[model samples]
Target: MNIAILMMQKNENELLKKWITYHSYLVGSSNLFIFDNGSTNNQVIEQLTNFENKEVNVLWDFNKKSDYEQRGSIFCDKIKSLDKEDFYDFYMVIDCDEFLGTVDEEGNICFDPLSLEYSLLNYQSNNELLMIDSQYYNSSISPFWFNKQPYRKCFFKKNTIAKLDQGFHHGQVTTSDKEIRTNLVHIHFHNKPYEIAKTHAKEKLTGRVSNFNLDYLKNYNGKGFHLVRFFLQTEEEYIQNQVTLNHIKSMSLYHKLKQLNLDWPFSSTINETREKLGLTDDDDSFEKVLPKFRGSIDYIAFEGEYLKIRGWGLVNYSRPIRYIFLQLTNRSRFRFEIIERVIREDVNEMLNVRGGALGFSARLKRSDLEDLTDVTASTAIVTFLNSECAYFKFDMQKKHKEFNYFSPNNLAG
Candidate 1:
């Protein structure tokens, strides 16, 4: 079947490359449709152009709208045009931050979208949509740590007549009557405090956002949603690390009444759906399943200063070395940012330091220096000692040798 993946995004430069890579791997580069909204980065356009030349279709609309209504209207119009041209048999509306997953009857893991029986997937909603819990992680503050809570659902299937709902959280399946019951998992990426703030700010500014309340989202306590901790050490660690990561759930009845902004009583709708599905919020059936190591490293610290982190860990081979160093000299606390700076068994150059290499540096302010020292002492340092590197001989007493920090730009030769 011909399947088209639709994505609407604004200022999505950070996720653009990785999302495009995953989409290209899933359905090939030819079946993707990207809609850009007010993106400031020209690099995104250039990348999309390259993909278009390779068969992907890229559409651009610069109209600024504070609500999803305008965005959805534009999306629907574009999809209608594509449908009239007989571009696709089935189209999936996916978010830039979500990754779709499929599971079998026997509960085997399948990551490929095309490998599953796509006909069984069904979209259900109450007056309120059921929020799925997710974990939040920050690279700078916490060492790749994650907390979990529930958030609103944002995936749906569309045919020619399908249009997004008023709040833009769910969609109406207008053309199909198929009672498909496929289970698809949504993996979200907004896990940091800064990320949460930015998202909430966007939603508040954009009046057309989802109707979901921000308060109900709770923090995950290291123990991921529906997963239990195992092993003596892990159980102890779980108990010790009682930190809450951001998660969102439907508001309680009283809170729902207090924040009664929507027309329908969401509490009642949620109850009815829960009863119909024979599912209880307290169901912890998945707790017995041991957490599988997806080979994800939560956080890496280097000298309590520079940090190299992957939200979901380093899953792709193309990811460069995740090593950075924080330089604390008399002048100031300089963060040396390096991306793939490890050259043919030697250090190349350093990107940013307090002062240029081979130069005398001034002292930092007393208060700033104290603060930097405190941060450096508390931060965790991660080093890839296993990776190839050259040994440097330094003369601290002689003060005779000059050294240069390694950076990508300096090594470009």
Candidate 2:
């Protein structure tokens, strides 16, 4: 094989056609070999087979059991194999969205059109191994931090004698220098929507296996990168700082589409996928759903049968007559049985608290403890008069990695 392109995808369809078409135009589709792992949709495989390049092989059931992260590492090891006997001159493994290219002496694209073959030829003079840059682009394509693509795709060399390390970003051999000098950058356009991006962030922050880098927060630009901030900040805070949302809400979708770059059709893809997913009515604006509920239910505990609820005053409402009410309910049926009212007189003392948090508990009767179990695990909810709430689960706090906490001084109003 001269140059073989390897790709693995799951549950992806929208961009698979474009990726195959563009790359096939660059370096003959005969060199393309896609490995589909458990794609629930048949159209994804059907489209790949529908291409004119019938010689392009589609391994549909290839390693369906393994996950993306494991498959990535596997591809690194088996970088070469043709007809079960031949070896290739070089191997190219990339995601569905990544496109490769080369640059000239002054850091300008060398060719009129993108050709992986041309890029490889042009990058020969630069270095022994091409250091493909990790450049990201947003779907919206605003001229600010979202649209500007990185300029460091160093067209790496194809070492004829030895193999190199391989992964999503950087792959090198143990004996090789493993130096990354960006000669020509590979374009990685992130087409994931805000909703999907949140899931990806949660995976990075909490999942057992992840592709996220520890220092990604400091390296990537903040405007469009919320995956990093998802762990560092609250969802409410993340939405407030998002640039693409701000841009979309300010302008019409038709207006933004007019500015879409043909080479990067992410904006158009976003619109199409957004409609297909039936997410036209989705709301990401934190300000729209942020509750005006004055304070937070800081803590909740149970002493045998007695329920102890601690809370804080959120605001300094000069009116002293209005009191705080604690509504208690059983988790089994979630029916409110006890309503204890506490005086809203802790605002003055809460000012000295760390977060202006105060302590308030509701009364409990032996009859109220009928459904509450001591052996198996029991839970109860404490609502703050439609303002705020907290749940008290027996010993569940230790199991949870993240918990919501609040300060009384931080009023929603």
Candidate 3:
């Protein structure tokens, strides 16, 4: 049974090497298809060159764009094209931080190729898209942090996959009643060790992910990539607390196995390995700061079921404001939604705000409101870090527009 593993990465040298080694063992080194995401690391480039000589098909980005959905979709199309030629019997696309394996009756996680093949083939999934459940681990505080809904990865049989959306978060199968679960689990080291995480986050948020998109912080595919505020807030905590690598991994391993009711029989070996590598929580690192909140709403528009707005904000002191509250009133009825922050340097400059990139623009869907007809009025508000808030209300029915304390040419006072 032939299998092909697909992957895309940029500058995650250590994790990328581990992923390649494990997957190469699962499927032969020759069958791995790696797409280098414009990585600048000399180690990564050198390794890719070595693999290329070893019959691994190393690919470069087809689309120059950094958007994951677009790039991932293009990769899936390439996979489908390869499937047409009957080159491989199965395909799996995964991230560098993710490791694929199966659990045995003795509760041992097996990374052996034969074990993975058996798991995939023997597992019963009525749907063509086989869903591999995930075990997500946190970087700092709670090691075995359990998500209420852990995401599932895809393992496609020959001709089973249609295409992947939003970087493999969901699969659009050609013919399938619904996605079915499989026993295969990919332990996702999503929370990178602090040092690596800093680079990864910048590459993702500022580079590939495009923080300028309106849906930047909105929840997409239950993954909450859109929850930009959550990401930022958590990052702030990590920096403030100075989270460490060893602590995260150690705690996660201990608690995750505990949650699975499995025993960690390799404790001595693990410790020895760590010691040999000189790994320590004290040495792990991360560094980044979220922009403060305190600006003005310079633009607002209503289109169909969506309420579009643009503004700039920045906090002077204390804890930064991470979210803005939008309140709507209709004949004693009230509805509101929390808006996460986004990059907006142009407006921030126009408003003469000291905080760079204080501008936020979003297209929010309001299913909560029956109609904009009777909405009567709305308020755009931002509370300061000290619990004091600045707000402005406008008549929604009469089409009143209220620019905050500042306008395009005028700075906020």
Candidate 4:
């Protein structure tokens, strides 16, 4: 199948090589098409020219402004022209920051786009448009250490009508009467460094007119990006750093609506128009929910029936407390034990005991803690604690009822 991978990029010189390598690995070297929107760097130009010789098409549109809406329209026109000329059978429109791939039924990597497309096409969907989710990452640091969510809408099919709508971020398809197949994957770039994230947020929040009510912009004020960036940072840093929670809370709904833009109002109106949709009052408290273990504590512990003890102190005097606490009047049992203290290079010798076990250690700063939440191990612990805590609480109530019904003294009598 003849396929075209289209992308628009700016100031991505360092990332071009990796992008080329990854796409080449997925769909060979010749199928890629890149639209450079006024790159000032000569090195990036040289790199693109070099890749052009290897069957990659590089079009430098220095005349075009870097506004996402205009660029998207231009891109759509280009795709239409290519389609008219019969240049490609299927076109894949992706961003410079996105990675497209698939996980098979067995969760194996299917890097080949054609194969991935075929698999998606054959896969039956209840809905028409197939929307693949985006996985965001920090390319400058560790790529694997990232977050995956349904960030973007990437469509696929062998048809002339398919086109990407205008806008720099989250641009939807403008045409109607088309079925959407939500099956492809578009890994977006969401959590970059602070400055870059702020710039992006400002552009997205202020530049584009909110498809939602214009009033939505009044509360946004470009602070949601800061909160999201803080969220992506380590949890410890988030806690320690004096972020204005009230500011975040006040702007959250507006910020989210701004981020979602026209899509939000469009969906809400559709729902409201079709039926009597009840609007729930907002009860989200961003500040009050922040994690409390910001400073050094005796030990870090997550407990349940199966206790895991870690930390230098666990091997010593305390012998790590392992007990199931029953709510005084409830039959349910709460089980817990101390987990190991995490050791790091930044920790001091006085805190490190048991050959660096029982040492004064800094708990993960809020930023680090946020980062840890993304880790599978950390998430697993959190999940277990949540489930076990709920179960134990329920069990205690049942036990209390049983004890009250058949007291030990009554049984003895």
Candidate 5:
């Protein structure tokens, strides 16, 4: 059967090369369709140059900006448009970090092309979207740090899907009860090197922050808040240490690598993947140290049901601070949930700290503030790193000299 695989790309050069090479070997390079999302990096540009006159087709027509909703809409619409062309038998949409492979009924991963094709053929069903399960490999933890779950990527029979949701996690199908489950899996490299993963985190949060309005901040706590925390932690020493550990662990796995039919050029293991791509591993050892917290609550105020806050905090030995809490005391003390963390590079430079995400910009809900309203100027406290805390005083009535005056132009109707 003819198969086409679709993926979107930005600046992930190394991962992109492995993806292209592996998928090209699985299905011919002629069937690979990559939508270049306006990559400006020289390495990616140079690599794209090598594919000229090659069968691999790279299209540059999709919207390149970081608006995910619009980009996702364009992606789904493009797929629907391609479905009309009648060029291929089946289609799969996945991210660069994901790899498509097949597993046996006993759950052993298959690497041979014939075995993979046989499994797909046996599982194929009409009027259904095949839901391929996923196994997330967190190399930062260890090469063996993997768990299999029902998280799926779409493997669609033509005309089975009407449109996919934003991330292509699920879709609106052409008919009800239209899913065909299979042992096909997408091995997800969720955590990569610090710098690359950091860039990815920043891009994701930027898209979220730009599109989600502040009026809905209360309802946006869970996923949106976690993204901010992750983006802030991108530069910390712990992440760096985990990355080094993964490399070290993968080296051990490489020594015992068993032969497979396909002799797969790309590995789910970080060290093996790097070696296959001709990249060197860092053999240097890193020491993990406990973090000590010390921070200041620079600004805090109530703006309707939303509380706006800003501050700078740091760990003494350059470790990442995961969360910061705001405790308000009256007849009773209440601790509010932190909504977001911000990177404070200026704080780091000024303090001469080696590493840490030392700044934060957060929003807290007034309803969650509860009945603890006896908060005077001195009742507000900020805490971090479990044991360290700081308190600051501010005018609740907006009468403090630093915050008293304002000039306005257009009024909301």
Candidate 6:
């Protein structure tokens, strides 16, 4: 059966080459189709010439057509315009980073998921769609890292044609028959290093740049992540220890695909993907900012239900602070949570933040605050965040103990 893949692109040159290389191995280089969304770098379009696909659609300013609710219809119309001779048994559109195939434990990409399915191998069926499962991938090069979340990419059918639903996040496919599930996995490159992400963030998605919230942008934490103990580690040291985290539920199917030897460019694509991790060679692309720890922060106030934190290091939101460095304790009990604040906001030019404080606040319920206090004394916490680049203070001692930070010689200590 013939297979074809479709994808949209904007300022996606950061990992564009590697993405194409991986896809080339999945479907032949010839079956890959791309729609250019006014790529300023022109990298996506430039690389397209390397392979011969059925069609290449370029609409430089197709913003209105790319609306969340209108994309399905726009893409369906384009698919119909393609030459009938080049018809495909299955078609699925995805982003540059999404791999609609499987990868092994050794960090290697394998064959298509369908070829390994036992039910499909014996079936002579049509009019059914496969809702491919996807796992989010974070590149060491990406800036903001969060807890992993799983999502689906597209819908594929055996015989009858179907169009992808409008929303990219939704896996629904519109057809005469309802959607049916299939055992397929796709990998999506959810995060890229901060430097590269910033380069494309403005134009990468709908309203990502044009509609950026200036008030919120200044306080944005777009830095790489690492534990505090590793803060002093050099950039080179971290590179040697980077890892590939997988969030998929099944690996049996992935491993079996590896030995099948269904023939495509596996080694070359895997190598290309691996080599692009740190992106260190390009000085301008990946900035290795030395982690600045050992800095002092202040516990500005213990407002009703919020613990206010401020200081020089926290003021500079340009740098990435991985986790929310916070700790609250009482006697032997303690509470600590990663500081991924829902409204990670900072002060805007209009003084939007309360008292124009240039930092973040960890809102605590009154009962939670009482956990750290007593009639005669209170508990204190000294923790570091930004993946451990900066520090914050949370002290509520009645007969307070000596604070090293408050000493005469330890202003920046």
Instruction: For residue 269, give model 3's deviation from the true position in Å.
Output: 19
lDDT of 6 at 96: 72
Clashes of 2: 16
Top candidate, metric TM-score: 5
Superposed model 1: Cα runs more than 4 Å off: 66-68, 106-109, 117-160, 166-168, 175-181, 192-413
**Any idea what lDDT model 1 has?**
0.38
Colliding pairs, model 5: none
Q: Model 1 over residues 206-306: C-alpha lDDT tens digits?
A: 43323224432222232121221121123224323333322112112123223433222123433453355453542221122122111222223222323
What tens-digit string does per-residue lDDT give for candidate 4 at 338-361? 334344333323322111223232
Which residue segments of model 4 deviate by more than 4 Å?
A: 106-110, 113-117, 120-128, 134-141, 167-181, 195-413
What is the total number of backbone clashes in candidate 6? 11
lDDT of each: 0.38, 0.44, 0.55, 0.42, 0.55, 0.42
Residue 218, candidate 1: how far off, in angstroms? 16
Worst 10 residues of 2 by lDDT: 404-413
Q: Rank by TM-score, highest first.
A: 5, 3, 4, 2, 6, 1
lDDT per residue, candidate 6, 350-384, as tens digits? 22212112333343333444433333233344544
Q: What is the lDDT of residue 376 in candidate 1?
A: 41
Each candidate's TM vs. the true structure?
A: 0.42, 0.46, 0.52, 0.47, 0.54, 0.45
Query: Looking at model 4, which ten-residue stretch has the lowest summed lDDT?
Result: 374-383
Please give, for residues 12-63, the per-residue lDDT of candidate 2 as tens digits. Answer: 5656776776666556687787877767668975786686346776776564
lDDT string, candidate 3, 112-223, tens digits: 6788778766643455677764443433333332121136577677777777875676887777857766656666765444434655655566644545344654543333
